[model samples]
Target: MVKYLIRRILVSIPTLIAISIVIFTILALAPGDPMGEFALNSGITAEVRENIRRSLGLDQPTHIRYIKWVTAFISGDMGYSFTSRLEVSSLIFQRLPVTLWIVGFAYLLGALLAVPLGVISALKRNSAFDMVLTTLVFFGFSLPTFFTSLLLIIIFSVQLKWLPFIYNDTLQLTDFNSFIELIKQSIMPIFVLGLWQTAVLMRFVRSEILENIHKDYVRTAYAKGLPNYIVIIRHVLRNALIPVVTLLALDIPSIFTGALVTEKVFRIPGIGALLIDSINSRDTPVVMSITFIYGILIVIFNLIADILYGLLDPRVSSTK
Candidate 1:
């Protein structure tokens, strides 16, 4: 297992490098100069603009700039934001926690709800409860996150005045009252993100369990006078969760991406919103660094998924 993990890490180095090159090249070729905004200022002369570009190394060839950026990135420097003039790493550190708090809570909550809902649905099969849940699952799946977010805001925030419409970034949880306020602001965003993920996960869980329940091992366990719960839990659920493990592990990347939309809707200041803002402003360094971070996350999560696959199913060898 250690050898396999080492191999995967070693392999990921080249993959990440290639991904960095592609991301850099694409951003380089993208329309909009970093100096365009500066040029728009009436007080800034062309010579001054040129000097600013030179200082930032934006005057260099694309390859040269890419090389310099990559070198800086390797040495624990993420470069400064073109617009904010803040260190890219510092900006990310500030916002990353907010995104993690929202997305992480949603993910765990969705998983917790999904397992039981899926088990009940599978057990009941075509019963009325199962049918109703199935319909609601489809409804949640069909609705776009932004739409759902708005609807939630309207119903909960605007109409009922039960929750805050937008998240408060400055709200610190130093007291119980502050914590309660944070929860109130977070509820809609968490629900919006979790609903779709739960719908998807529940369907997978139901399908996998239903397929496993008919297998020979389940039947044999039942024939041996095991209770229905014991047969289902011991003989069926373990195998059924193998694929679900893969699904959940691989779905981490999507959580971050989806948080982009949810954050925008709720006006949360997070990495996703930062990325979008950077792209619009043509802040190449911020955009490039964030994109690279995303690529790294995807690779890391995929490795985790592979490791989890081995752990969940001993028949699947990790060293292989």
Candidate 2:
């Protein structure tokens, strides 16, 4: 296990390097100037903007800039944002907690909602209850996140006035009331995210469970006088869940990806929202930093999924 893990980590280093290089090169070649905003200023002359751009090292050859960026990255100094002139890491860290809280909890709620509902729907396949769940799941999956977010805002925020239409980033959690206020603002975004996750995952869960339930081992467990529920839960579900675990591992990292639109809709001040803003402003340093970080995260999660496969199925580790 240790050897396998070390091998995976060693392999990931070069993989991450390749990802960073590709991402940096693409962004470097993209047709957008970090000084675009300055160009819009009627007061700043073209020559003044050129000097500003040169001062920021944007005038350097792409290879040189890439080399400097990579070196700074290795030294734990993610270069400053082209717009804010603030350290990229600081900006990410400031928004990281918010993204983790909202995105993480949303995924958790989704899994909690999906697993049981999927099992039940499969158990009662073709029933009215299953039909209703399927219908709802269809809408959940088919609807774009922004549409659902707006619908929620209208129903809860505008009509009922039960929740805030926009998230309050400035509010500090110094008291219980503040915490309650936070939950109130968070409910809609979480629901929007959770609903979509549940829709996608529930189908996979139901399909996996259905495939496993009638297998030979489950029948043998039943023949051995095991309770039906015990046979399904212990023998069937155990095998059914292995692939689901991989799906879950991959999906966990993707919660951030899905949260990009949700965060913007809710004005949550999350890392996703920051990344979008940075991209719109063509803050190449910040864009490069965030996108590279996302690449790293995907690699890490893939590694984690591989490790979990070995843990859940000992045969995998034995083979290694």
Cα lDDT, all candidates: 0.88, 0.88
lDDT of 1 by residue, 167-234 (tens): 99999879999999999999999998789889989999999999998988888888899998988777
Best by TM-score: 1
TM agreement with the true structure for every prediction: 0.93, 0.92
Instruction: Kindly list the per-residue Cα lDDT of model 2 for residues 1-320, writing each as its tens digit.
Output: 88888888999999998998899899988997778788789999999988888887888998898889889898999978878889999998889888988999989999999988999999999999999999999999999999999999999999999999898999999999999999999999999999999998898888989998888888899889999889878877777778888778777775554378999999999888998999899888888888887787788888998888787777876777
TM-score of 2: 0.92
Off by over 4 Å in 2: 41-51, 255-258, 318-320
In model 1, what is the error at residue 205, expressed in angstroms? 0.9
Worst 10 residues of 2 by lDDT: 250-259
